[model samples]
Target chain A: MSERPPVPVITPGALARRRLHVMFALDCSGSMRGDRIASLNYAMRSALPELLSVAEDNPEVQVMVQVMRFDTVARWHIDEPTPIEEMEWIDLDAGGETAMGSALAQIGEALDSAEAGPRQLPPVIVLASDGYPTDDIDAGLEQFFSSAAATAATRIAIAIGSNTDLDTLERFMNSPEARLKPLRANNAPDLVKSIKWATTAPVKATSSPTNAPDVASQLALNAEQLEAPSSEVVW
Target chain B: MSWRAGGATAIGASHIRNKRPNQDAFYASPTQQSDPRFMICVADGHGSDAYYRSDIGARLAVEAFIEAISWNLDSPEQINSLPQDIVQIWRRLVKQDIGRNPLPPGFERAPGRASDRDIFEPYGSTLVGVAASEQICIVVQIGDGDLLLGYEDGTINRPLAADTGLHGEQTYSLCLDDAPQRVKYKAIKRTETWPDFVLTSTDGVSKAFVDDAAFVDVVRHYRELVRSGEDLQATINALPDWLRQVSDNGSGDDATLCLASRRYKIQDQ
Candidate 1:
């Protein structure tokens, strides 16, 4: 008989299968003041924990999140992502010029150092805005969407008000297939729903939806029917 | 009877013997004799996607690591050099090797795939590995995985250290699916007077042993078990169950570990 010791049998355990990291870029510009900011605040307070549930017991499956609030200049309310349990309600003040450009720039910068895990999904950036941008929208969008890095990143957008420029917001989403939502209500429910969808969307490493717009309808969309063909965007 | 060279190695390894949809790939070799040189490499492919011929990707990674070191094994000095643009070169080589395998049936091959990134599409897997000698230790990873070093004193340390920060933002890991630019690396000079053990694993094992102290304890115990004259195969046999018990049945990604001790015989040196 062989004298070598016997090898042990390892029964596989339930691992935290799905791991994701999501970032939210909120438009705290003057147009987002009053009801808009309030709705966003309420939505965030209710949504962050639910998003954390995606990780389950897998402490390794962390969602390192960051929030950038923009007016004339983008201010990082939560520059680094805190654990969902540790996250707090961010009270945004709306009075500065719309610096959506600066906000996009910051979003790109923050994702630069982001890391991935075994099943790391692409970093998800959700941009929520209410009114038309007072800043150069094209330049801001370009800054956020131009590079291969930004294009490689997953971007989703939610148009918050009737005055919310759908065309401009479309540009804010980096992926042609970026998920988009039109929020008709300045209420708490709509805010929370939009936040939930943005954080939970799968951004798996291999089959990252480069054109997320096609997948947008899979997420929450506004009541009004969109005239834009979702298939048009690819990058 | 005296301890003989190559008589045994303390490296501990265990995996479910039965092939389950996804297979784990690993390679370990004791390259240096005098300095007790050794290397452990591992990779885990996502099991869900068809594009995840990650098993092949993982196998390629370990093979490439072995081949790279083997090509330069004579020059012990080169391991610490971390050669200029070595990271980039290593990345390119991995991409090429991973792409060399024929695409599974129903997958189309893109002709004249000009770039490393382009030809190596639909490929993803986490890679973590270590190359060590008596005097030096080097670790590198791109995506998520863990590297552990157990010293002779029973003291254990994780090279990436622990992310104890509020949100643990500083922690980094490899993702098979990240852009080549996003791939990161970590390396350090080895400094230990006694025999040490090194292990590299996919997230499967990391998840099983999430708590550093708890994981280190298991590793320490297993090392002792093997050193006590238990067959290495016995220790390997026990790993999966122990991991399941330790993880309390968390997520089940393919788990793997390559354990090797620094003690070698005078002849092998």
Candidate 2:
């Protein structure tokens, strides 16, 4: 009888996987208190599974998530880029002013390769806000875009509720060439769908083996298709 | 002079949920026996919904690569232009496949379908391969993956560096509009005593390692196995199981490995 081939010993380095950082900057202002904040929390928690699915499909690319909440002050709810499967979402309560500028500044700082891991995919940044900024939006955006990593990041903005400042959100998108408009969510269902789309679509699209067109261009196309009258959710 | 070649691919653990076919594909020409000339190609399909037919695309890519090299074997100019030739043939095959198998009902068209250029989006995949003759070997790659040459002196090195990008998963694919420009090509001349073996694999294997050095060590380990003379058939047969463990514990993505080795006879034997 032939002897069986020896079982190959697995090495420690054999388990290493590449990472994709995904950051969420949420507006937890006074205006977002009650149902709005509740919906945001629910939407984010629900989006976790879909995000994990993306990570599973693209095993070479591990999805690491970071979340920042901004009210009168901006701070990281989850500071480090934690693997999506291992990450736990803590519900954020709403109060205070919309210091979105400060949040953007913080996001910019985190975008630094030194701060984030040097070896990671271009990050996916999703900003969901229900109100305008109470601070210098330009100053924050400038600081954020200064980092080449941040500039290359796929940026998506969600205008939650009717009071959102679309102009500011549009500028945050930073893709004038793609002409992608900010996603709008008028109700709980709309907010959930928009959040789901914002979180998963870019990760899925950008992770393709092909030279995926810019996320902004892809989003613009999605927006057009979703905006059609027959579509379920109007973005 | 003859060669021993074998290639295999395993589905990622993550794909089991949907029962999605293995998105990675590989082909080794002259499968029947050792040949002085042979070609080996491996392709990884884009795992996005937009790339619905990427599995087929990957298979077509390897087939096209083999066909291109086979047709241009005797022509130095055509061999040098393998990158361009492969893409041309690949695009033609993709179009033909699309014509034969129309999109399934209610398939979502990729965004920005204004022209024929967008039509190839569904069949997006990355190609990395090599064609070798008795005297020369050519390596060509369009996207992410590793191609390494193992020398008889126990040194192993990647012929073409893995394309690094801010996004780890993003890579140049054959479906890209600028694929012709993005494809990387390298030609290696075989010496009397060097590069005893060649291995081509998708990112799944390398990404499983902590770093490039660690990956090189794994390749070296394989090189030792091939050189161990413990029965080539056994080594080849055990590769898929070994790769399955690599993916299960590491990247959990589809993994593929194609190997080619130069055989030397022992005068005493």
Candidate 3:
């Protein structure tokens, strides 16, 4: 029940969407050369469908994935940010000493450069490591977290073995915000579970509200209650 | 001096799948209202486990807006107190509702809730409100939503400043402390000239777009749509479906759009 006016104007045909970036920093140190790296590769492949499903369910943000590997040095694994569906994964080669700091710096630099606008969701970073860093972690972290994008990112870590340096991981995952300690995985099966969890949770949070003020904290709380993985130390 | 106005609120796609209620609420006075001023409001409740009561909170925010505008509709100088009045009235309404339905025994709060004692957290919401007469137009915003003033010219003006906190990643809310102090207020009273129309929408509508200019251009297109339509009612009727599509593929959050126009004349059927 309103007044008469002019003819209707056609709107643009396509819907515009925001982007949500998810990155993985895998530890390819010498300790992970055998069963550990193999489990990681398998776990990542298994996790993709679940992540893709979650991303597809919420079309609001274009879910993109980036990957990096670290041993004596860190380098790009995926090379460029790719949509979750198109994010192809290859088995990572394990080598040399842990360069956890170098890995953080590499991913950090990428996020800093790809920096999100008001419409974009802050990037989510998942760090998986099996041992202490052989590189300068403090300097690397400083370089990585210098940007606002890195500052606001959701950071998660996977402790791949009994020898994981919790202190270093904790530094990367600044406390209070990174509510969950590094997800502990002492064996290959546990490693797979940790990787699956690390990949999917934050990606899902990027698209869905989950009815919480802080999805990261909620994820941390849930991760804590997960049933313990196998007790056998197979890593 | 008559006005033409309509508004719509649609449940978001994500909310539908999650079984969450539509957290968006709105009010647009009809052209035939007896009140001299045409008032419009769009409110978005912070819906999550923490804001369990936000749907009600959003409803109350709209009611509070109407209540606040009623007092200051004619007096532009008294506009400074509008935000305070809205907060005062909304909290009172929320308290009354709380007394009627107290938090159940052993009812756990959302884990990420800001503070355990901050009972208002369950009803936090952001709102943009406008009360316009032929001569005076008043706009007030408390959080993350769009408020644009369209002119007879092709240009558009955003009454509120840029807010980095859109789509509720973080935002100010009526339920938060010192809310009135955070409110961004603007009043325009020009007998010779006024905005041709005023447009406001929750962030969900904008989230479906690439950027602010694109979203604003869409608002301009809606105005053109109304101008081109055989009747403004047709355009109004089309909003819900359009918003549904935006939410389905864009923000996946509740969407609401409110428009009030003095420039467009509605021919009575």
Candidate 4:
């Protein structure tokens, strides 16, 4: 009988990888008709490459993206969770009243186990809004947070411009223990930076093999860094 | 005493971007003609930036486990203390490694968290192992992984209980504060009919299966294949490619499997 090799033959198939679901909730209210909407579109479109890079690195973590837009009513700009590499950003126009509440409710329903497939990793939900919700914000948040998946989701809210409702955004961020504060972007540049950071950083951090803070806390830390320079800016 | 053993470790397809080393490590002690004992250990490093050195940590864990077992072979009471003893040895090794290799800049705290002290966090990894002699088989696990015993009757049984509330992609690790308490231990006394094979693997391997039953089928299939073959070395050589296929078609993660089997005698006509 031939002697067995000293080293075990290592193979590639034993690890069972998982998928990560990332959803974007955008506000397409009339207040965001000009630069705000344009910046949001540009940020979303440009951030794709980075997101795809994350997906590529974490091959085990298949990234699926879903886009939801809310104005007079909430609707799916991209209803299905498409692989990050294949996802294309459809530019959204802003012209109707903000329906943040409806959007949240819709997302909450989708997060339900009955509607969503087997829960993979905790889903990442990013919200970008420029105004107060015109609909029933309380009911919407109640419905959204009711689902365990939604409650456990890594939620981040981006408040565009000073006029945006911080209270609504804060309420939307339900993970108090996570210590995540809403990101406030006062201009187009800040908006772009916040969107890119909010979208990509958490994904990259979570995908890492070490212990990582939940997505909410990660975003909060990034928001603090983004705001640091502004506080130091000398006019 | 007759035993045939082979094992392997490879990088996951998804971790290419970070150029992350394969965080999974395995060790199969060379079969000694006199010892009549077989041992194998497999570990998976936690996949978070905080655990930057988890690849090395995993290697340390398996090595430490094997060493701990060898030193306590005569004492069954020491075997009960194996979990704590192994962790202590692993921590000592990690501390020594850290002394030689300082943490890179900005790794003192976990990324994005100001208060978290992540100095030792990078060495976190999950460990699962099996040590078997002619009369007894022992299984120990800390965190997520699969360990099974295949009987001559073509049945595979998992020696460890399922981890509950460990939802999607989350697993306990040796670096966690409560790791010592979380260690699971099982010992099976060998009967007149010895188990056909003993297999231990990290989560990557088990995640590829559709369900637990399917996992058992794969174990049974491997046992049957090994039992049918005369050239044990050739069969071991062929395992890597088959495992790669399983990973490519299933989870696309780094997959590893280690097998220790008892040699079967062929009947003469």
TM-score of every candidate: 0.52, 0.82, 0.88, 0.80
Which ranges of candidate 2 are over 4 A from the true structure? Answer: A1-8, A17-21, A33-35, A41-64, A80-96, A111-123, A146-154, A175-180, A196-235, B29-33, B103-114, B161-168, B190-194, B264-269
Interface RMSD of candidate 3? 3.6
Tens-digit per-residue lDDT, A1-235, candidate 3 = 3343332232574356678888888999898988888989999988888889888787677888888888888888897889997877788989898887878877777876784666677678889988889999999999888866777777888888788889988887785755778888888788778778777777776666432344455567668854487656665
**Interface CA RMSD of each prediction in angstroms:** 10.0, 4.0, 3.6, 5.8
TM-score for the B chain of model 2: 0.91
Query: For residues B152-201, what per-residue lDDT tens digits would candidate 1 score against the true structure?
Result: 67777776643221111112212212334333434444443443566676
Give the lDDT of residue A148 in candidate 4.
75
TM-score of chain A of 3: 0.90
As for TM-score, the candidate ahead, 1 or 3, is 3
Instruction: Give a tens-digit lDDT track for model 3, residues B1-269.
Output: 65677888889988888798998899999744323468889999885566778889889999998888877776667888887888889989888888899976644354455553366767878889888775677888887888987777766789778754323265777866767777787778875457767888988888777676677777887666654434566667778887787777678889999987764555663
lDDT of 2 by residue, B175-216 (tens): 877788788887776664447778889877766666667777
Which lDDT tens digits does candidate 2 get at residues A106-199?
9888878433432345788999998899999999989988877677778889888778899898888877564777887877888888888889
State residue B46's C-alpha deviation in candidate 2, in Å: 1.6
Candidate 4 per-residue lDDT, tens place, B1-269, comes to 66667777656665555577788899875432213678888888876555678889889999888887776565655677888888888888887897899888767666565532255568888888888776667788888888888887887888788765443355777776666777888766666556778888876676665556566677777776667654445555676776665566555556778887776442221
Cα RMSD, model 3? 3.4
* Stretches of model 3 off by over 4 angstroms after superposition: A1-14, A175-180, A209-213, A227-235, B31-35, B108-117, B164-168, B191-193, B227-230
Q: Rank the candidates by lDDT, best first.
A: 3, 2, 4, 1
Q: After the best TM-score superposition of candidate 2, give how far the Cα of residue B89 lies from its true spot, in angstroms.
A: 1.2
Please list all clashing residue pairs in model 2, or write none if there are none.
A121-B166, A121-B167, A122-B166
- Every model: Cα RMSD to truth: 10.4, 4.4, 3.4, 5.1
Q: In candidate 4, how many Å is residue A79 off?
A: 1.6
TM (chain A), candidate 4: 0.85
- What lDDT does candidate 1 reach at residue B235? 52
TM-score of chain A of 2: 0.86
